[model samples]
Target: MQFSIYSKPSRKKAWLLSALAIALLGSCGKAPVQNQKPATEVKKAAEKPAPAQAEAQTGKVVVYQLFTRLFGNSNNTNQPWGTIEQNGVGKFNDINEAALKGIKELGASYVWYTGILHHAVIRDYSAYGISHDDPDVVKGRAGSPYAVKDYYSVNPDLAVDPAKRLEEFQALINRTHAQGLKVIIDIVPNHVARHYQSLHKPEGIEDFGANDDTSVEYKRDNNFYYVVGQPFQVPKPQNGYQPLGGEAHPLSDGKFEETPAKWTGNGSRLAQPDFNDWYETVKVNYGVKPDGSYDFDSLPADYATKSVQQHAAFWQGKDVPNSWLKFRDITFYWLDKGVDGFRFDMAEMVPVEFWSFLNSSIKTKNPNAFLLAEVYNPALYRDYIRLGKMDYLYDKVEMYDSLKLVMQGTGSTDAIASVQQGMADIEHHMLHFLENHDEQRIAAPEFAGDANKAKPAMVVSALISSSPTMLYFGQEVGESGTLDSGFGDPSRTTIFDYAGVPAHQNWLNDGKFDGGKLTEEQKQLREFYVKLMTLSATEAVFNGAYQELHTVNKTTQGYTDKTYAFTRFNDTTKVIVASNFASTATSFALTLPADLLQQWQLSGGDVELKDMLSERKASLKVTGDTASVQIDLAPLESVVLKF
Candidate 1:
């Protein structure tokens, strides 16, 4: 059953519940009296040897996504539609060694530097030989990062010197690598800005649609589809909206000239797309004709089981469409510059064949490159990972959606077990996250209304499987995305305007890269994230076998729908995780199923359970096919117990 997204407790109730949660936060890891056995007795019982799995441990990946333009900006002058000089933009140089070191300390192996690509911003850079973007087509003063204007260049606004933007980006990449962390950037293959241009393209490389026969609606080699005889007409302003908050600009006359208009980024074939359409960008053509027939070669039926090298060799001598070749070259350019990988935007909108060709090429250059995609459909997850050769796909539809429901108090923790069991075959390929640029922050009023409420959910998302865990920049310190940034509404961190993240700024601490100004609660929250993330990345158990205990413990004493339990074990370490999603304290007997106990070869005895994140200790009683621990969980508390 689907849970209602809008269902929430009353504001007064929520505030009181959250306050109680914060007050009890210090005791979340405390051991219960019933389970707190003598140290001598617990240590003696824990000395019994357990069987170890023969399989070698694989390391888990932890990703930190930072909005490049906002991460280093210290400005709190949050005036709506403010100019760059007023709002202040963070430069590439601002992400110094100290910043990289700070990120590394969070146990992030890869840093996804978003909005590094050149996009259609409202600001003029004619002096730097860049053409001006019309304010009518741009989303906001800063424009959408997905509306890429140039594939071969970095955003000029991100550099101290606009003329040396590429060099500055390269230096940042170097700094990231120096900190023992890999770098990731965006590669939007599905579409491009309506006014696409490539001033710095390599010799003999033509810009998109440069060689197209615009008189016709479709061509196999054309980079974009056309609307035939219709010229482009901008969508009328809706809800009393105007460019740059009604401020007058030279290009704010609600006019952008495009003869023989192309299809919009969302595949809207109309020359005059609806106001809600993605009107700022145009879709790219990848040999799919107007009649919905693919003109390009399809992959072999057996290619699903083949390696990336095999897929690359299959297209070695075969001719590809111009759009495919152009994207391949664009990716190669970044890979050559030491960029570790790409995060493809709206990947499912593009065909699987293009991904097979492009991703295979990327693997040929850097076999270890991280290729993540945004694929929301559950049925296409396997196809995208197996046939398309993607390294990871956002686990939004199942994992993230279900967890959000539980956190919002509209769903049961039982639903999480079902979701995990269903995706067991491909769990490792799924990437888990609580927040991104596109989603509402956990601490936002529209969501859980308190950052502390997400602690239990974060635990399950990060440690439930072998998948990578991604954390947004300010999520650690609870940056509620409630600001009314220009052209972007509240409840999500804005990607379409210039703004400073207030909570992130507290940790940024005026370029000191310290949490000097953070409150006690925020500091504790960050410390919890550091410990959890570091374990997720370094612990071998996270990369090993997982068994759900929630289903078996349903009838156990004090176990309710609001509580969940699970275990992760490998050759060397075994852990039990218990979480309480309720806004009040809970007491339960967390159980270990007979099958799992058999796998670990613990027949019967007392076992020591040490809280990994705190100094609390507990005792597990295992009696002939039955093993259980009495657990006490505070509001929104999650404990990782190691035996």
Candidate 2:
């Protein structure tokens, strides 16, 4: 279900957008049309019906993150919801057409709208360092959908009638099914929009210093333990910031920074409670201005509140709505929405008890719901999986290190060995990706010169890695950007590179903004990816555990540095993944281990490698004492061969 991630102005050649179309290049697709059988049953016609067949394996969940503001499908002009000026672009009159088009184009497993809720008041809409005007960021008619003033209301900018959004959304989900895709939506659980109903009347609420809290700072681990024996502790705000109470903010007279969540540079380590209040401007607390410089964090965290139990007298005696107070309600909401899983937002901030409670309840509704956390450390990964409670977290350390080695022209089994080892017990729980929403794109703007090379290499690594893959919006489709130091560009991402942009649309008729040219190369790569993913879905080794097999080749630069080989073996399947990152050809000593020698397979040309990438042949050969493979690693080139 994983789709293309590439999206942007950065392209390789004129055919850059058509890159993923490699699957269809000089080759046939998997029975695009089934052969029609004769009307009369002549083959095995007399036989009686056999027993029912068992169900096939579960399907992978494909999630597409939609940037509503940039969807420029003008075809919906007279459809429904009135006309919506998406950041001053053409208006969308209907949602169904867009939905239908998205399914037809992306072949997504799920359609995920990044933010669609409504906010009564909106002043500040900046996320990371980017705003709506950025080439990739869309400045819709309303504002940033993240700043939700009303949870129940869908942003009219996204779907005109707030009441009709759910229906359209359901239709979109149905359309996804029609294309063999699923649908997912983002759910922010940590903090409500600053202008939440409770914050509507901030005049009556108690306001304390930012990051001010009554929390008793515990020694090393001085926070409430969600579970009985765990050493996990909640983080307390350093600057004494306390959470707001009871009332919400009033109708805005000014910007959001002045609202309750605003923080001054007054203290060092202060944590702002609300991300943004709808009324006046409030500075959402990010990292602190350090002693000499500052620290930019990808995932931001705030202090945890006293447990609902500790304040026994406060809520125990009084009556509070369980729907509003109970944390488990969040899990139930997604379940009701038919989500297959949740990719937790800044999970470290949410207590483990929340997960334990969620895991227990989620299974009751749907035994197959999966949960993935987004943390980037290895040690924490051990604790989460070791305890057998949490699902998976980010493994950036491994990815970063591996990428660093690959870029530097040096790599080893030891480079990614540790993480591979740690994944032993929880392979199914692991979530893997080359790039995601929070981080910068893998192919940085540096690729303006040569995305041709950057893409193949990057794609190979992502597809062959050992984890349940998750891709940020445009990666599979070749979205090239890298904004690590600041918030990425606003309009720089391709949330709109979808069904609206046809591969053969006339550039003159559609105008440049319609994205007709963007998919030219990516479509090739995406189709290739589809074949690879479909193959991976059927191949146990690709989705399961992976191990590295060392090759002691000494002559070629890439034979060692340019090659990446992995072996995935479980009780039933054994898969060997070998890749070369060098732009040129390389040679591996044709020495097969005892286990491999026993299997009968062709060498080099004799053994045609059906690379999952584009379902094309990755040139290779087995010669005397050496098996030679001429991989097109012209620059950032990569290929995965399975034997």
What are the root-mean-square deviations of the candidates from the true structure over C-alphas? Answer: 14.1, 16.5
**TM-score, structure 2 vs. true:** 0.59
Over all chains combined, what TM-score does candidate 1 have?
0.91
lDDT of 2 by residue, 371-408 (tens): 56654435445444432145556555565446545644
**Model 2, runs deviating above 4 Å:** 1-55, 58-63, 71-108, 117-148, 198-325, 385-390, 404-414, 446-450, 453-466, 481-520, 551-558, 568-575, 595-635
**What is the model-wide C-alpha lDDT for candidate 1?**
0.83
- 136-229 per-residue lDDT for model 1 (tens digits): 8888898888899998889999999998888888888877877788888999987899999988777667899999999999987899989999
**Model 1 lDDT at residue 524:** 94
Give each model's clash number.
0, 81
Note the Cα lDDT for every prediction shown: 0.83, 0.38
